[model samples]
Structures are given as C-alpha cells and as structure tokens.
Target: MKQIILYAIFVIFFTWNPAFGFLSGPIAGRTGAPDDICGTKSCNDPPVCHGSYNINSGPASFFITAPSSYVLGETIDVTVSFSNTGSGLHGFQLTALDASNKRVGIFQSKDNTVQTEAYLNEYAAHTTVGTARTSWTVQWTAPLANVTYPVIFYAAGNQADGEGTPEDDYIYNTAAVIIQPTSTPTPAVTDGECDAETIQLSQNLLELQKGESREIVITVKEENDCVAGGVSIKATIKKGKKRISLFPESGTTDEIGQIAFTITAKKKTGKATVVFNADGIKSKLKVTITSK
Candidate 1:
C-alpha cells in the first residue's frame, strides 16, 4: 500500500499537473507582451514552480538580427539567436508589427525546426520545444504597399533545463526595428529641356494562353532622358485572384536601367493587372489569360 501511494504521488506531481511546459510552442500573442496577463502568467501559474522570466531587460540572452532598412514589397530574412551558452534546451517565437500595432508582414519558416502559427499566420515558433537550438531563421515579406515606417520585430525565447516542469527555466523577450528607405529628390536641370523621370515597360498589355509564359523588360529614365541605372523596382498584383503569377517581383535595375520579369498564366483564365513601382514612379501592365 505504501509503494502504491508513492507511485501515485509521483504521477500526480509529474504527469497530472497542467503547468508542465509548452513542449511545443507558446500560445499566440505571447511575444513582446506588455503585461503579464497574456505573457508569462499561464507559464508562471500554479502547479508549476516559478523562475526568472525577463522581458526586454538585463543582459539580453535573446537577440534579433535583420536589415536596418527594407524595400517595399520585398522579402527579408530575420534571424533570432540565443547567446546563452549554458546547458539547456531552447524555444522561441517571433513576429513583426507596424506602428499601429497591426501585424505588418507575412512570416515563413526556412526549415522544419520552426512553424508558422495558423491563428494569424503572423507568428513563427519552434516546431518542437526543449531542443538544443541556437538560432532560427524566418522569411518576412514586407507589405505590398508602404505602411508607417519602423516595422518592429518582436521575439520571445526560453531556456529550459531539460526539466519536465517549468521550474528552473528562464524566459527572455526582445525586439528590433526596421524602416523603409527614403527616396531622394532628383536634382533640377538648368539645361535646354528636362523630362520627368518615367517608368517604361516593353509591353503595357499581354495576352497569354493558359500555362503560357512571357517575359517583359522594364526601363527607367531620368529627367534628362538618360537611362537611370540601379533603381529599385517593386511589382504587385492589383487585380484578379491567383490567376497569374510573376517572377522576380522586386529587384533593382541593371547598368542599363533595365530589369526583366517573367509572367505565367495559371489554371484560372482571367484578366489581371500588375502594378510596378520604380522608386516613386509607377506603371501598370494588363494581362489577359485565355484557355489554350
């Protein structure tokens, strides 16, 4: 009877308790929490012992690395690294938001170690908890259009002592910010004549059969009618659903102020409009896809 009671106690303490640990990933909205209610409250609740969980304080054990500036509609890589060299398993969650607090970018995991949450599709977390991972890399695609500057990337990570419970574990939160590159004004020319900078496309309209592909060249010209090289360009689908697709959606012009993109017709047959932005100048291409 005594042995049975001891075994029962062990089961209740280790298995029956609800505050063991996430073991997978934390709940949604747990990154960069402004309060304890939605952040570490559940993890630090009863049934589990508490430990030091720091929020954007002390020697940062968790760090976020990303470009200081990003081009509109471009996909950038963001990495979250754990600097603590201690012996333990680690897990993390990362996300980005605009100044309005609205989720700004789409996050995609580069490997199986991380997974994008289905709740808002904005949160990326570890696939399995309690792993000896030092860092995670995720792709974040900027919004199709420019929003308020300074998109903030927030992340939260934990170092677990490989214990089955939350005790002796440490949680850390940190953030980083990125902004859009500012456009420089073109200098005025006092010459005989001046033409405003323009974005010219090889073809303004396209007709392609289903599963057909076509390439288009974009050229940028300055006010002096000279080819302006090294110009940033971004393309976005303005109309139609997913009937058409474009490759190299965003890039910089070559030495000849030219960039090429391939457009392909998908299964659906319909009309689609692709808007292109060269620096601040804008242009559009109309595409019609028909049955083969």
Candidate 2:
C-alpha cells in the first residue's frame, strides 16, 4: 500500500506546471500527416499520440512594442506581432486588461479606436503564414489618459489532434502590454461613472470592415440635445470580439442625426461594436459589414 501511494505521488509531481494547468490540451483538427512514430501504421502496428484536440498548433509567440512612454490626451500607438512555427495551426486572440486582469476602457465599441490581428487562414495577404513561419502585426492607437497600468494580450486558437498538445489554445507565450510613466496626469474618474449624460443620442456606434466603406457621423448638441452645429464632434467605437480602431478622426454629422465616414481596406475585416463619446458623455450602438 505504501509503495502504491508513493508511485502515485511521483506521477502527479512530474505533470504539474506553474503558469497554466489544464489550458494545454490534446492534438486538434484533421491530420495532414501522422507523426513519424505512427507513419502509415495500423493501431496494431504502432501507437498514435493525441493533443490539443481542436486543430494542429505550433509555437505561438508575440511581442508588444510601443512608444517608450505615454502622455495624457496624446494618442499612443501599440503594435504587436504573432508567429506560428509548429507543424499544426497555432493562433491566439487579443484584448486589453489591467494588471489585475480586469478589462477596462471603451475600445472599438465607439470610434473604431483600434484594429485586431487575424490568422492568414482567416484573411488573405494581410499577414502571410505558411511553412516559412512569419510574424503578423496588428496596430491600435488609444488616447493615453489613464495612469500607468499593466495591459494584457490574450492569444487563443484550436488544437488539431488528441495527442495532448497545445494545438487548441494558447500554448507557447503571453505577456502584458506595457505603459511607461505618463507625461500628463490622470483625473479621478474610476467610480464607474463615465459622465454619459454628455453624449449626443444620434451619434452611436461605428462600423468597420477589411476592404469596404464605413460611414461615421458626429455632431455638437445644444442644451436640448439637438445638433447645435454640424461641425464634427469626437467619439470612439469598438467591436465586441476584439477592439479595432476604424478611423483616427471624428465623423462629420450633417443637419440631421446622420454622421457618415468611410473605413478603408487598410483596416482588416471583422464584426465591431461601436460606442460614441462626446461632451464628456458616452453612448453605444452596433455596426457590422462584410468587405468586398
């Protein structure tokens, strides 16, 4: 009995990893070719291995590079690159979270504030991937107003076979988006109150697509919430899946509650949830379109 207990303890000790436990999985997706150990062999001839059982995956690595420091009210640009180099398909997802792992901010729901990265299998040539193994870039710019906090990047994908590998989820790497000391100070506004009353109702979400036209409209509202001036006021928009900036500038609201601006192909393709911010207030709306 003592020998049985000791053997079980040794086996458990050898299998634990500190960072993530069950996140890894069995091989996933259909197999193009079996491992050398099981090449063209029947079950009786050789045994097969399984892992991350959703899709084939490889080593996934990414890095975030931004301006050395951030400044309040100044737009700071962030760039990230992802690389897949394993035998199977390896991929990941992205979002911004504070050091404590809480997602904070109004990205993409309003102004199309930032854009996300897609795998080559999802899009055409935006970021090429194949046997050579390369990195793809996704760019986003946000107005740096919050005090320095850690931002996290999440990357997730499928695992092909059931060999207990990282083909299904984030397998190889992950990190926090870095922010340097702010050149300007942040105002106290963490109470969860976003001063939303200041937002104009007509101006809502912005739509984004990879290679199509997007129309965004903004306006300055009077005390009664009517358009005081057609001059374009500012706002931000985001899509729910992942925040991607559609346009850099505000859209022009015409006499009516219609503000129209077009998003170009340089911006990739995906569904986006938009939010409009104005006069210290914020509001939300949705726009989703497919590219030509």
Candidate 3:
C-alpha cells in the first residue's frame, strides 16, 4: 500500500502543469548546456526538458549582423535577432567567442526581455508576463579592437508551445557570424585640396569608472584606416575637467597620424567633452564618467 502511494505521487509530479511549475515559462539560463549553445551540438528533437506541442519542420531562425571588418580599438555595434513560426513562447541564447573561445567586449540589452551573462553570453526569453511578438533584438559592443583573426558569434533559439511538454515543441535553431579585422588602409586623395586631413578620436564614447585612468587614441584618417600624415592635433577638456585631467593636451600626430593621450578622472562627472582640434576643424568625444 505504501509503495502504491509513492508511485501515485511520482505520477503527479511529472503531470503537474508547467505554466505554474518551477520552469513555468522560458527561464533564460535554466536550459541545460551542450544544448543551450546549440551551434555545434544537436538539441534533443522532442526537447527532454521543455515540452513539445506541434512537430514543425521549419526551424526557428537566428540572425546576426555586424560590420565585415572593424578598425582596431574601435567600438562598434553588433545586432542579433531571432524569430520562429508564430509561437507565443520563445527563448534564445547568444554569445561571441574568439579563436580560443574567450568572451569579448560588453553587451547591453536594448529591450527589457534581454539580459547579458558572464563569458560574453546573452539571453532573452518570454517573461512570466509573456509576449505575443515572436521576435527579439539585442545590441553588442565589439571588443576593444585589434582582434587579428575573427570573432565568431553563435546563437540558439527555441520555438516553444507554451504548453510545457517536451514532446511537441521545437527546441533547436542555430546561427553564427564572423567579423574580421580591418585591413591596412591605402592613402586616398586629399579632401578637396586640403594640405592635410583632419583628426578625430577613434571612439566617440569614452566610458570610465570614477578615479580611473584610460588612454585615448586620436587618429587622422582621410578614408578609413589610411592615416593622414603630418597632421597636428590638440585636445582640450571643454567642460568638467576639474575632476578629470588630460596629459599632453597639444601634440602632433606620428607617422600614422595619430596621437595617444591619458585621461584620469578623480570623481564622477556626468559628461565631459574632449575636443580634438585639427586643421582648424574641431571634433569631440564625450566622456561619460560613472561612480561604479
């Protein structure tokens, strides 16, 4: 009699409604690994964990878009998106790994559903509130450049039935993107009879933690990485420098037509503008200082 009761309890456990159970709906990281990153491995067809509803032949689609090549140390944007065959429940995991499988750069979510994880991985799923839309989007800042080979991005998606069964849901779809390093630039024609080209900082957004120092790179490129030769550049803090300092405010570009400077901030400054003056043309980089 005791054995019969124990068996009955076990049956109830598996039959419990998933909508109210531990995993209720698309918990971002709970999906087991090896399968979570479905790029190289196969996810179980009838997903042993998540339930299945309809056996759909069409696979969910994952997409990544980024520049074919990027300048060294340049911060650029990368985008990822996913969609499936009209499923109310969806979840996704995406990450970028270098040649050695090391996570690179920082990821910031553009939507509430998306969240970044350690090791350059990011996830998005239908919250408990859920959504009728079948697609999600996210943005990633490329790692501080100079990555010679290529950075590969891998993503996986699930088209769940929302019924909480592993039998009818479609669990696996994968995509990848490769970004290569920008090649050396060949000097292009002068800009409309100018003796020398203008210069600007390679990055427009400089984010720093309070009481921290970072080196900023200034470059004069007429076209792409082709550095303009013999250009003079000067940097000045237009505002909020009382809490920050820049070294060698005035300098001439090297053979590559670039100047490197250091910025040290003593406290949080909501925003500071670093103005680059070259050939009478001025450009600015916004320095966003944070306390944390």
Candidate 4:
C-alpha cells in the first residue's frame, strides 16, 4: 500500500510542522512585539500592531491587574491574563512604559514560556512543554523617588486555532493599566500645657549669653508625693518671639520624674519667660539673653 504510506507520512509531517500544517499561534515576539514594533508602521507593511487585525471578533480578552496608585521606589505585583472565547491557543505581549515610552522598573516571571524582550516588553505564548493556559503573573518595581508622572502598562493578546496561519486568527485584544502617584501626608504639629497637681521645676530662672544654650529640668509627682514618671510636660516661650529657641519644647518625665529641655538665646539682648505645664500644673522660667 504505497499510496497509504504516502498519505500517512504527509499527515505526520503536517501535524508536527506547524509552519506547514495545523499549527497556528505565536513564536515568541512574532505577532505583537509591544509598543516598539507593533505600534510602529515601519515594523510591518500594513502594521499588524495591536488592534490592527480585529476582523474576526471573539469573546477573548487581554487584561492586566495592578495597583491603581503606586508608591515611589516600591515593588508591586502585576498580573496579565489572556482568556479566549474558544479552546484556541493564546499568546500575549506586555510592557510598562513612562511618558517617554521607556521601560519602568523590573519584570520577573515564574513561567518559562514568558520572557522579557527588548529590555522593556514581556512575551508569553503556548509552548510545547506548557499548555495554553490563560493567566500569567509578573513582578514590577516602581521607579525611584524622583519619578513624578504616572506609568502605563500596555498589553496585546492573540487567539489562534492552531492552524499555523492568521487566516482564522484573532489579531489582538488590548489592555492597559495607569498607575498614579501616591499622595504624601503632612506631619502634625502639637503644642503643650502644665499640670499643677503634681509637677515642679528644677530651675525658676535661666541665664544665658546671646549665643549660649542651657538645660532646664522639671520634676513631676503624684498627689501622695510619688514620682510621676511618664507625665506629659510642655514648655512654651510665652513672652519671647525671636529672643530664644527651645529644643524639644515638649516631652514626658523620665523614671525619676525629671524632664529636661535645652533653651538657647537667639537675640543679643532680651528678656523672655518659658512656661512648663502638665495636667493643669504650671511653672515659669525667666530667661535673660545677653551678649557674650
């Protein structure tokens, strides 16, 4: 049966060689190569970029999942999925670019079929060792703290009937993600008052040169004369504007009911008063600032 043998050989060769027979799909960076080649008109004669070949519409979709807002200099998880309507083979190309179309952060993948291309895009397809799965994951790190603009991730997917041709294939389904910059919060400033029920000052007056600094200490006690450690105390320059400066103007008492603060004179010659208060108890310190 020579004729039968020839038919079997033909079938075997066509079945194995997708380029000649029933083998339709991507060959890693074949169809859509990302923003570089795909979107450019010079890559192909008619430019088969994403959305270029959509005549054979299907329910297949390509999408990416990521945070709506990203913190600068942070790593985040990004996932890309290409789900086909029917049981056809699917492939995808994904890339994250800034306003200048340059790659952002780093890309890492656990699947061997998926790989980085042109240092900017990632390409994934159904390999012989892997099945035509619909989902894949990738890791991306945000840009440095100096980056202020948003980043965009673009992706394109193709679903083919494994026929080794684009005749019945769905060209591309697109997806994108726009990552905005996270907002920064301002620090809150707080002021303090005294506690007369259980607090005393180590000094009632502070003498300092125009450019000198001195430490003022305070003592806290309970109603029964017990050391009130951890009592909150606040010091304020009630009578001085630019004459003096206080270091850590507010703090809590230590284990020995002692809280110390540093005061410095900012003027050549002036007089000022500092009031320390905690839980309604208050004390005063008269500061005399003079030239050296």
Ranking by TM-score: 1, 4, 3, 2
Question: TM-score, each model?
Answer: 0.51, 0.30, 0.43, 0.45
- Give model 3's TM-score versus the native structure: 0.43
- The candidate 3 region of ten consecutive residues with least summed lDDT is 1-10
Tens digits of per-residue lDDT for model 4, 7-88: 0000111113344332322333232222344342333222122222331245676567788667766767777676646744
Number of the candidate with higher TM-score, 2 or 4: 4
Off by over 4 Å in 3: 1-47, 50-56, 72-77, 82-84, 117-131, 145-148, 183-292
lDDT of 4: 0.51
Comparing 2 with 3 on TM-score, the higher-scoring candidate is 3
Candidate 1 per-residue C-alpha lDDT over 126-172 given as tens digits, one digit per residue, 9 for 90 to 100? 76632557788888888866454336676777666665665555666
Steric clashes per prediction: 0, 73, 11, 14
lDDT for model 2, please: 0.32
Residue 50 shift from truth in candidate 3, angstroms: 5.3
TM for candidate 1 is 0.51
Better of 1 and 4 by TM-score: 1
- Model 4, which residues run further than 4 Å from truth? 1-35, 42-56, 117-131, 145-148, 183-292
